[model samples]
Target: MWLKVIKFIAGILAIPLMAAVTRAFYGNIVGVVELAGILKYFMWGVGAYIVLHLLFFKPMFIYVLGHEAVHAVTSWVMGGKINSFKVSDKGGSVSTTKTNAVVELSPYFIPIYAIILMAVYFVVAYSYKINGAVFIFLIGFTLTLHLVMTIEVMKIRQPDLMKSGYLFSIVIVYVLNIIIIAMLFSLLFPSFSSKKFFADSYVFSRDIYAVIIRQMFF
Candidate 1:
């Protein structure tokens, strides 16, 4: 009970951080818009996925498969022994000997499908000289797939969210998503560095918290 209470407080405190990260994401995009070479391929891939989504061609089964696989993989990474794993078009579940915030909430944050795609790219690159554009396009495609599914799933009550306290789960998921996406952007776009991202995040967080403090006290 006390642990849940602590998580609740931490969750509330994390709102400022989430907002800051979100601001940094927008700022990062604005910083780099030179669509000449590789960036164009990335944008093309993003646009393609957007088109697919609009046509109601969502691959829910694929999302569910990757989602449950992440749960099982994260459990193993955290020293938990998996008992059983099941995934279907409707939903998925994984049972492990260990349970924690990381294991339970990982599917929401970790883009397992992206990692799988990256692995495939690496393997192909090892043998053949993979084009930079192809790599960027694949990253863009898989990343969109992960982000879209994550947003849709978060709309309703999830048992995973309940375990970690829904507020805390959401804060963690949102903040991690922002950070992960920002890191990927930084890697792909040299002009938009992570250093600038952190600086912007701090400024945004400070201003948001300042406003909240003033509202409460002044």
Candidate 2:
């Protein structure tokens, strides 16, 4: 009963969370648009996404690996012992001694591949003068891959969502993905700071909430 109540509350909160994220996303885009020469690199990401789809490079194996890996990693971080980890082209899963919403739902929100690519980009860029175009292009490619794979996985009835209650899971996933998308835009545009992105979101959310209250009471 309490769990259901919590889920209901989470469902309600999801609306405002989504509104905040949308505001933040718009701000990130506006910041990117103001920067010169950055749009081309971003387009390279879009182009890479188009080419991958055209070539039918689904790479289901890698997706499965990352999915299971995220589950295992989060489980371990939560002080849980992984009993088994398996990955296949068809699907993959991780079994742990402990389970919670965070461990169960993390794979859907955290883009492990994108994070790895960012680390590699930093390392390689530090060692050599890498071409900015290629670096941004690869970032775009990997992030697009993550987004596609995430959408594909979510289309079916995922056991993880069942374990973490559908409403709660969806809310968490939606908000996190929005933040991730905004952060990616910030990464692409050096002029944008994540702090400002979040601050703008807070202000936008506050104004939205004030308007909502006025509509309900006034």
Candidate 3:
């Protein structure tokens, strides 16, 4: 009975959480558009996305490995012991003694491949004058890969989300993905700060509340 009540309350909170996240994401995207050379970088990203989409590139092997790895890693972080880990081209899963929403839902939000690419980029950038266009293109390519694959996986009924509660999982995944996208934009354009993004979001949220209050009274 209490669990049902909790889930109902969480579902109610998810609506507002999604709204706030969408507003912040839109504001940051607008900010990114205002920056110089952003269009060219964006084009590079778009081109990369097109190429990947056309190729129907699906790194199921790598994704499966990362998916299970994230489960194991998070479980360990939460002081849970892993009984076994399995991965294949079809799918992957982990067996752990510890289980929670964070552990279950992490892989959906964390882009392990992108993180690997960024780490390699940093190392290469230290030694070579990597072309700006190429760097931006790769970023776009990997990001699109992550986004597309995530959606494809999410289309199915995932046990992880079910165990975590659908409303709670959706809210968490949306918020984390929004924050990650904002961070990626900041990485592409150094001028756009994550701090400023949050500040703008706060202001936007406050204005929205004020408007709602006025509408209620008037």
Candidate 4:
């Protein structure tokens, strides 16, 4: 928890550093134009992203499954039993012996790791003018997964963590942002089912994390 607080502080401190880098790399106006293009890509990227997740990316499903598995396994390892685990096309959950800090956190961290891996891939894809299609794939996949996983992480049950008022408030604000973004995505792309999209991603993270934590700890 203290580590996370420090990370949060470091992230806040990095804003100015990022701003300086942006100014250095591309003067303000140019930076703005570049940023605009990236933003525009998001809509097209959204379609590409959904299609990839819905079809091409079996690894993403495995990662999500591992995430939930971590949560369930961790709970059991910490002396709790999983009463039920229900998986579906949309989403699923595991009713456990009980919730613990470590167990609850499993889902959150697995997605963070997955996000980092995706970030690395995105950086590499963009760095080299690799195929435009590849860049599109990386961008779409990473953005959609990152956004949805963030929603799930913030949604997890964590009363102990919430007892720290600061963390509790932060969670509320973060989840609200996730909700707003998801709504915006839904409005922009009416073809996808917002509820199913969010729920599936959420469950995937939790179960995959559960399995990971269970393996690591046990």
Candidate 5:
């Protein structure tokens, strides 16, 4: 029971927590910009949101899809035969008859691919750097996609990894993710630390039912 509880905490904290943090901080800043009598803030916010969701949706989805594909492909490459694979709105799973550290670890190493994509983006946009505001919005989108993938990887695929005192693994994933996010931001905008964003957080999705019930009477 304790093991499950710890695993749940670790898995949830791995990525979703950080993503939630980013949203909270950015959302709050946007709100503050609104309060500062900046009409353009809202315009930029809305425009950026719409453009990001529209233009990047397909590419991000492909990235998300390819992310899982990497896992499956890696498994095959690592001498593990995949038995079954499933993906849905919430999570995904891939069963294998045999597993290796490399295959099992592939899902958590998305920053490697992200780095390559970011490089290509920079090269194409080389003459013009991606602007700061746009970069913030882009990282926000990327982080959200990352959260979804992390939920799939952490909660469903490798719950045991976080539970096994593999604190080193968690650190590695966190640092690598931060680096990739920061670099991607640097390519366009000035970078910010995860700490600057989310100071504290609650897992809203996991507690949505409770939150709804509590807010219903209020």
Candidate 6:
């Protein structure tokens, strides 16, 4: 009963949360014309993957592989032992000694391929300038792959959301994705400010929720 109420409230809160995050994200990226080249490559990467998606070339096995890997990795990071891992064309699964909201939902938010790519980029970037558009293109592609797969997966009933409570899981996944995206933008653009992105998110959240509360009660 209490859990149901909490989930219900969580679903309602997602509305303001989305609005605040969108504002914060837009505030950070809007009118930052200096890094237009980088943004272009990134967008090109996004569009490229989207085109592939339209053509039905998006690979389900790859996403399923990454999805299970993220679950296994997050489990390990949290001191949980992986029991078994499996991935097929239809879907994937991972068993861990421990399970939590983060473990169950990590695959939805963490683009494992893009994260691996970024890690490699940082290491290689330490010695050599990765100036080619190919890097950004790959980033865009993998992230979109993650996004598209996640959206498709989300449409069905997920045991993950059920374990965490669907409303709570939905809000958590969305907010974390927004934060992750803002952080990625900060990494890609020299002039983009992560601190400012967070600050804007905070300000928007505070103001919007305040108005919402006022209208509901006062």
Going through the candidates in the order shown, the clash numbers are 0, 0, 0, 21, 0, 0
RMSD of 5: 10.3
| Candidate 3 global Cα RMSD | 2.9
How high is the CA lDDT of each candidate model?
0.85, 0.79, 0.76, 0.52, 0.52, 0.85
Ten contiguous residues minimizing lDDT sum, candidate 5: 192-201
Q: Put down candidate 6 lDDT per residue, 113-182, tens digits, no spaces.
A: 9888998998999999887688888988888988988888887958887777777777888888888877
The TM-score obtained by model 6 is: 0.93
Q: Give me the displacement of residue 47 in model 1, in angstroms.
A: 2.8
Stretches > 4 Å off in candidate 6: none
lDDT of 3 by residue, 106-195 (tens): 888887667777778888999998886676666776767676777778778589887767776667787787778788677766666788
- Model 4 lDDT tens row, 40-154: 5545766765676567763434445655677788888888988987665355577898785556555543434334544565587667655544444445555566555545445
lDDT of candidate model 5 versus the reference: 0.52
Residue 44, candidate 3: C-alpha displacement in angstroms: 4.1
Worst 10 residues of 4 by lDDT: 20-29
Worst 10 residues of 1 by lDDT: 31-40
What value does the lDDT take at residue 125 in candidate 2? 86
Output the lDDT of residue 142, model 4: 56
TM-scores of the models, in the order given: 0.87, 0.89, 0.82, 0.33, 0.40, 0.93
lDDT tens per residue, model 1, 1-218: 99999999999998899989998878787768544556778888888888888886888889999988888888898888989988888898899988888988888888887777777877888898978887788788888888888888887868888889989999999999888777766766677788899899999999999999999999
**Candidate 4, residue 4: how far the Cα is off, in Å:** 21
Model 3 has an lDDT value of 0.76
- Candidate 3 vs. true structure, TM-score: 0.82
Candidate 2 lDDT tens digits, 138-180: 7777777777888787778598886667777777888888787
**Residue 210 in candidate 3, Cα distance off native in Å:** 5.7
Colliding residue pairs in candidate 5: none
